[model samples]
Target: MYEKELEAILPRCFEMYDFMAEHVEQLQHLEAMPELKLRMAFQSGILSFEHGLSSLKLIADGFTSSGFALMRPQYESLLCGFWLMYADTEAWFNKLSTAGKVSPDEIKKLETPLIGVMLKDLEKSNAPAHILRQLNDFRGINNSAFNSFTHSGLAALVSNGVGYEPKVIYDSLRNCNAVAAINMQMLSILTGYEEAMEPVRKMHHHFVDCLPIIHG
Candidate 1:
């Protein structure tokens, strides 16, 4: 029912969440300051989001690259990644909506309902409904954060560009950073108990341990 490697990895996720939060707070403070600080905060905020997104993708790729081996590898990484992507995209959509640049139809076109997407995938894969429900709950939390950031109404602050005051930018960045942090936390939970992950983790490690040589 559990895996050891996942246990080893769970703490790392928590650490990442805390680390991301510190940056989010810093960005928040910087947003209220002068242009110089604002630019820096925005850059940091953007970089953080990018990093968070990359991390999610990497974790997902780890699941997909192992030839879909159920024992040696689990697709939980991909599952979690989908959840995060769903959250991030929803946030962007909300932000655009708050800015009055997008209509409800436009928002609908975006992947706002990530939980449903994952559930659909699970159903297709014939995975356990109970587990899928748990994943859905996690996705819901991330999606909520996305909504919060977008709903906070940071569009005007962004439209003003780099000239905006640090304080305003910082506040906006706080929302951005919070979403990123939440994504990291979700990843941690998914990967928290390596024993839960079982042979899948070992299989993944084995693949990494063995790399095929390429000749030009």
Candidate 2:
């Protein structure tokens, strides 16, 4: 059954993996002025990739855990939480990606519900209804693992000249990475592919590697 699902998802996963991989590599090339500046510039790309990976992990976990009888008890709720986390993280990344692309005023202007677009795409692709609900639930939860970080939060504020620090963004990006790694390990197990997590991991590393160009 799991293999069957993998067979269905493999094509989409591979495609998304490649798409993300390219961006990650491109992100690595973006470099800033000083060492700290360079690190800061790369941080958002890292966070976006990690958060995306976490989303993929949740989907994988939920699908995998749904198959068993006894394991279902523990894994079901875990899977649910991960699913919500995935949606929330992706929303965060999409928000940052959009915000990062524009001026401070533009960031403010772009603050509508864009994640709804992504959710629609997911629904059109036949993503589970429950997963969609999970995402919606996550949207309500303000207690994010990544967003609460001082550096990341401050950078968000500072970017808009809101008198916030930049260091918060740096810390938040790391927090995103930590969650991604942990989440993907479980996904790898569920998908029965140690390489399941490879694409995203490599994507993050690739982005980090290209920090030089992205900063410019």
Worst 10 residues of 2 by lDDT: 64-73
Q: Name the best candidate (by lDDT).
A: 2
Off by over 4 Å in 1: 1-162, 194-216
The candidate scoring highest on TM-score is 2
lDDT of 1 by residue, 112-196 (tens): 3443554675555544455455455544544433333334424323433433333332232223223443333333333333333
Query: Per-residue alpha-carbon lDDT of model 2 for 72-155, expressed as tens digits?
Result: 122223333333323334554466667767877777754323444545544555445653554444434323422423234543
What would you estimate as the lDDT of candidate 2?
0.39
Off by over 4 Å in 2: 1-10, 32-41, 54-138, 141-216
Tell me the lDDT of model 1 at 136. 57
lDDT of 1: 0.38
